[model samples]
Target chain A: MNIIEVNHLHKKYKAITAVEDVSLVVGQKEIFGFLGPNGAGKSTTIKMLATLVSPTAGTALIGGFDIVKQPNQVRQTIGLVFQETTLDERLTASENLFFHGMLYNVGRQTLSRRMGEVLEMVDLGDRKNDLVKTFSGGMKRRLEIARGLLHYPGVLFLDEPTVGLDPQTRNRIWTFIHQLRQRENITIFMTTHYMDEAEHCDRIAIIDHGRIVTLDTPENLKKMVGGDIITLSVTDRERVKSHIIEKFGLPVKESGQHLQVEVPGGETFIPTLAVDLGERLRSISMHRPTLDDVFLKLTGKAIREESAGAWSGMRVHMRGRR
Target chain B: MRALKAIYTIWLRDVIRFYREKTRIVGMLGQPLLYLLIVGTGLSASFRMSFAPQGFSYLEFMYPGIIGMTVLFTSVFSAISIVWDREFGFLKEVLVAPVPRWSVAIGKALGGSTIAMLQASILLLLAPVIGIKLGPLMILKMVGMLFLIAFSLTSLGITIASRMETMEGFQMIMNFLIMPLFFLSGAMFPMNSVPPWMATLMKLDPLTYGVDALRNIVFAGSPAREFLIQFSMGTDLAVVAAMSVVFITAGTLAFNKIE
Candidate 1:
């Protein structure tokens, strides 16, 4: 059964349209990725599903409850971790989880047990009694993830969950996310601008200009981007390009110092082309299409080109102030 | 029941945060002491030269006002914390919870009021130090009146803070609003024979009745100071209670409008 079903969701703010005709379904325990550049209606759609923002036209069902008609039920069923830090800095980690459980009406008896359970799930068991102010950025994010799960929500919504963390912490968080899916069987619906993160999702919906451009499994989506990319550096690059195009029946585009070729299989194509142009080839490298390539092929722009800041996760090393 | 728990949860967080900041407690308690003991003693000495009533010291007249000042400042700080919460993204977590929006606002008001009341009760301990004897019943009555005032002021603060995005903005606005609320409350002077315009302004200020109610409880034993009480306890309670309802309702409405 699907945990979340969104139908043609739309949102408009006066003269501007934030989300236009967004429709998707997330199956139970599926790791769904809502991939988009900043301000591409990623947050708008997530907020609508979370019942934080009202949809203008379409309706959604979260955990079999209508988002508009039964907002509280939807809220009860979903745990939302916002893009920014939301944990109370003054409170201890356990206290933060306890209050979150209280907000969800988690029973008194169950709350203490779940507090320990969720904290342990996030690997923050030892830091349970420590103040959030004393925590590192990664620890704070883990605690928020812990607080979000204290109520045993059916779906966990993480909005840019790893935007500000270092690569190591991001991997650690992804490990926890996978554990949640495997151990708790909780569906995670996340939005992220990072292409590598999107590669980890069971399925990804690439949204652009407040619309979903494509939705498919990461592998299938990469396949849709079409073929392995093989780049060759040769002294006579133009001559090699003609021989490659004539034999492969494909177009070769010049990419700076290399002649880039796209073929059905890079591993097979590289060996055959290498033998033919053995003495002429200076360098040869092949890579499967990345999500960034997928986005560029579909949207004609790199995802990172539109991202505003390169160091959003600088909170990891800095202890100066929040 | 869930809604009530949500309110309690929010209130608990604020209370925990309040006590955790040890400096805040010291500041809250120290300000009122400076007023009641240092400045108040200096002013009472001049009153002794003029009227010279043994039991009717200026300290007795100003005690309620000092408490009111403390309540006002504490409550406003709590409201500013709401703005801080919003700025720092903590408010988003509360707003997205399954609980109703009104519960969050009420919880904030309760938290702020409870902190203010905590400060007031501690200040109430100083009554004996200032030569004002208070029975347990009087203390209970005083606590109730103080809560009403704190609740209303915190609600008003929330209403204003809800629209504010930054701490400095809320602080700037509260500075413009709090001084008039304190001075016009008749906290420093007896309200019996004020100028007509000043009387009209004091009547408009909600803290005026709150301070008056505190004075009624404090001046019960001394006939000399009792005459300085402007309104009956019932009238003062009614005014502050009405304001409490209005401010809380407005605060809840403001919270509902938040994104």
Candidate 2:
């Protein structure tokens, strides 16, 4: 069953149309990703679905409650982790969850127990007494995820959950997120500009220009890129190209100094192709198609560095951490 | 019961934060001391007790007003922290919760008032040093006045702050708005014999009655001396309570419109 259903969701802020004609359904316990560049309406669409902002047109429902008409019921059934850090710096990790419990009407008797359980879920059980101000960027994100789960929400909405974290930290957070899906049986709907991050999703909706260009499983979307790219640099390029097409029945093209072909299972095809080419092949390499390629194929432009690159974000964060 | 819990939880968050903010504690304790020492001592030598009731010293008069001033700044600052919370995105956490918006406003006011009252309680300890002997009855009366004034002013603060989008606007209000409210509140000067225009403004200031009410209770302990009471005790509290409802309602309405 779909945990969230959005129908023709539209949002217009003054002159700009932030979200234009978006519709989709997210299955229960599915790790759904909204993949887009910044200003592509990713955050705006999520905010509307999360009931933080009312849509200008159309409607959405989460956990059988209408987002526009029954926002209070929707709020009770879903947890939200905003793009920016939202935890109170003055409060300890446990205190933040304690306050959340009361606001969500979690029983006083069960609040402490749930608090411990959620903190443990995020691997933050030891830092419960520490103020959130002292936590690192990654740890704070983890604490927020833990707090979001304390109410036993049926669904969790995360907006750029690991935007500023390092790569290793991002991977760890993804690990926890996968575990959360498996253990809690809760649907996870998150938005990301990082094409690599979308690869982890059960299905990705590639969005651009305030609309969903395409939605499919990551592997299926990449299949549109004609599978993994195999590049073979040979001393006798024409001879190898002819041999590849004759024996392997695969067409090969020349680019600069290398002969390249698109193939399925590039890793498995490499050894066989190397034996088939033998002495003529000097160097061989494979480039797997990523969600970026799918985005490029759909939008005709790469996700720009201004919004999607993680390394640029990493440099700003590394100033103090390292 | 759940709504009440939500309000209490929000209030508790503020109290816990106030406890940890050492700079705020210092400011709270130091502001009243500075006002009492500088204003009271600076005016004591030049002033005559002829216009004053019961031959009361100038320091004795400014004592209650100084505590009211402390409550004023602390309470307003507490409410203005919402602007900071919005900037930091912490306000969204509260806004998106299943709890109603009115509870959040009430919680903020209660929290600010509690912190303001706590800071004012420290000033109560200095009463004996200033030559005013306080009975337990007088302490109870003063505490009530502190809470009422604090809650009312905090509600006023929330009403003004809910629409403010930036912290830059915060300092401007503290200077251009709060300063005038304090100066005209009859805290520093005699309200009975002020200029016609000044008296009009003083009557309009809520802290005018708050300071006057505190003075009455502070001196009520010492029956031998008569203190200046601007309005009847019941009338002062009634004004505070009535205005609190107005401000809280306005604040909640403003909060409802926040994104």
Candidate 3:
């Protein structure tokens, strides 16, 4: 059963097309990830699904309710955790949950029970009375997750849930997300640019320039990149490039001082290549294909290049925090 | 029932926030008191009214206007919270909720009006110090008039704030409009003796009727009651009620279009 079905969704802002003819389906209890760089129409697609932004064309359905005609029903069936923090700073943890519950028309007794259950799940039970302003970054994220689940929506949409957190905190948030999937039996739809994080998703759609370049499971996507990638730093790059081309008929590209080659089994071919090259090979390394490689192969540009500024800005912000 | 509960919850959040921040009470009340004391006392000696009855002073004439000022400032400034919530991302949460959008606007208007009325009530307590005696009936009438004035002013505020995006821009626009509205409302002088053009402008200003209604209620049994009748109490109330409906409808439409 597909919980979310989007058919040729398109969003246009005046003269610019933010999302161009996008379509996908999210199955029940499936952890679907939208992997893309900044401004790849990822957030726009999510906003359309969440019923926050109306599409220029195309349509979607959530829990069998049309997004355009039945917005209230769609809103009731989906929970959204936005990219920016949305909790009232003046309200306490329990107060925030209570406020959300009331807005969703949850009954008093059920609200109280769910409040305790979510608070305990997020490990904020001890600080329920503390104002949200005093909470740490990790604690705030946890509370937001708990708040998103208070209404018990069947599908939860998280927009970069761990963007600015440290590695440890990011791991803990993913743990909570995985636990929620197993314990509550809810489908999770998330968007992220982190390659390692995308590795955790059951399936990922790599979007670039307002289009999905590829959509497949983590292993299958990596497999699309073919075998291991081998790089050799040799004194004579041109000589080695032609030698490999002549000996094995494998295409070799010269990158600065390094010679790069792709083969079926990188480990099995390294010995003969090294023996033939003799002392000309200064250094050599073999690595399994990662999502970054897949992105580079599909888009012809490294993902890191697209997010370089944001990554550095995040680092500066983190350093200032410490 | 669900709509009412949502409205109540939204209104309660504003009340809780207002009470928790103690400085806001002092800040909201400070300006009205200054206008009443310094301006009232200084102008009283220089300005004596011939239209007023024998013993009525200029301070007495300005009292109701000052109440109108308090209500206007408090009610309109409360809408700035909309811009604040937008900047901080909290407004998106409220906007995306399953409830109807008008309930959010109504909740904000009621909350703002309640706060404005509370400020007006505090000003009402100082009536004795200013030589105005209020009976129970008069006190009830004054409270009722203040609530109407607050509700209308708050609706007007929300209507403007809904289209605004930044706090500074909203405050700048409010400052530009509030002073003109205050002066044109004839809060400092009687509307009966103004120039023809000034009278036309004053009649057009909604706050004028609010001030006029307050003056009528505050001076009902006094010697100036007959002169205050120039602005009919029933007419002022009716105009205010109609304006409230118009402004609220406009506000709800504006809020519904927010993307």
Candidate 4:
């Protein structure tokens, strides 16, 4: 069954259309990943589905309940884990879960039962009484997941689950997400900037500038890009464009000092092409085309660009405050 | 049953959080202590005069006022932490919960009120050292006064907090609205001693009613202070209660409206 059906939803923040006529259907027991650059309406879309933000236009249905008209019902069915940690730092992990469970109208007996189960699931059972303030970042994050699952929600919405964590912690979170799916058979809808995380999802939608550029399975998306990603740094773009067109007749997408050649079986062609075009190439590198490569091909810029801009702007803002 | 449980659960979480933040707890007591020690003592003899209402000592008159001030500050800033929660996403957890939106706002007010009441009680405990004496009945009346004061002020604070889009904006409003409310309500000076225009503004101020009401209950049957205190408390409660409903309604309306 399609557990979540969002249809042509539009959310405008005054002059800015944060999400414009976007739509997607998430099936039962599947990990649906929302991939986008920063400020691309990924979080906005998830907020609408989670019923945290009302859409300016259109509708979304979660578990057959209309988000606009039946918000309470929509809220009941969806559990949201936001981009930032939201647990009460002063409260113990169990107390946090207890309150969260009660807010969803879970009975005392049931809340207690589930609380223990979730704490064990997150591996915070031993430290349930310890204050969340003392917990590490990854531990806090794990507790957040436990809080979300306390009510046994059918569709869990995780927004940028691993944005600022180290690689090892990020890997650990991925394992937990997988474990959650295996144990509960719950549907997961997650928004993330990490292109590599998209591989774990059953399907992904590459969203940018308030619109979905494309949607497909990870393997299918790579297949659409059609070969190893061949990136080159060219000294002279005009010479290189003509040289590549005349000599190799291979199609190349030029993007500011970088030429991406997406030939069928690009890895096999790279060595021969490199021999012919020696020294003309400032650099030569080959790798399997990833979601980032697909995003670059479709959007004409890397996904990392917006992320870098967001990070620097955030850093500057924080420093300015200090 | 479930709804009540949800409300209690939400309320309990706030209580737990406030209890855990030791600095915040100490800060709550610190303000009232400073008012009692410095403001209440440093100027106690200097400000004392027969012209003062009922010929009461400055400390005696100021005790209830300090109690009112404690209620005022704590009650209004109750939702400050919520703005932080909203920004951090803790609020989303609550917002998406199955409970009603009014409960959320009320739970916050109740939490803030509890803190205010606690602060007021602590101020009352320091009453003896500050040279104010109260009978057991008067102590009960003081508790009632604090509860009402805290409840009303918390509603006002939560309302303001709900309307605020940013934590900075909320803190600004707190400094702007709360401090003025305390100063203008005759907490720092006798109402009769203030300028005519300032007196007129105080008469209109809701905190003025709170101060007057609290002062009357704490010092019952003082002929000079009786009429104004009862009149202010009675009217203040009604007005504040009505205002709280409007603020809470507006808050829930905004919560439902915002995207």
Candidate with the larger DockQ of 2 and 4: 4
Model 3 lDDT per residue over A65-165, tens place: 99999998998888889877889998889988998999999999999999999999989999999999999989999999999999999999999999879
Better of 1 and 3 by TM-score: 3
Candidate 4, residues B1-259: lDDT per residue as tens digits? Answer: 6567766876787777777778887888887788777877778767654465655677777788888887887777665667667766567677778778777777777787887787678777876775556788988877876876787677766666666667667556757787788888887776766689988988777778778767767666665564235365567667656655666666556555533
Cα lDDT tens digits for candidate 1, B1-259: 9888988898999999988998989977888888888889999877662443565678877888999999998998897788778767788888888888898899899999999998888988888878789999999998888889999999999988888766557546756798889888988886666789889999999999999988888878776654677789899999999999999999999978977
**Cα RMSD over interface residues, candidate 3:** 4.0
Q: Each prediction's DockQ?
A: 0.59, 0.43, 0.43, 0.52
Candidate 2: interface RMSD equals: 4.2
Error of 3 at A169 (Å): 1.6
The CAPRI class of candidate 4 is: medium
Question: Model 3 off-target regions past 4 Å?
Answer: A231-248, A251-260, A267-284, A311-322
lDDT of each: 0.86, 0.86, 0.87, 0.80
Give the per-residue lDDT of model 2 (tens digit) for A142-198.
Answer: 999998998999889999998878999999999999998889979999999888899
Q: Best candidate per TM-score, number?
A: 3
RMSD versus native structure for model 2: 5.3
lDDT score, residue A52, model 4? 72
Fraction of true interface contacts that also occur in model 4: 0.70
What's the i-RMS of each model? 2.1, 4.2, 4.0, 3.4
lDDT of 2 at B125: 92
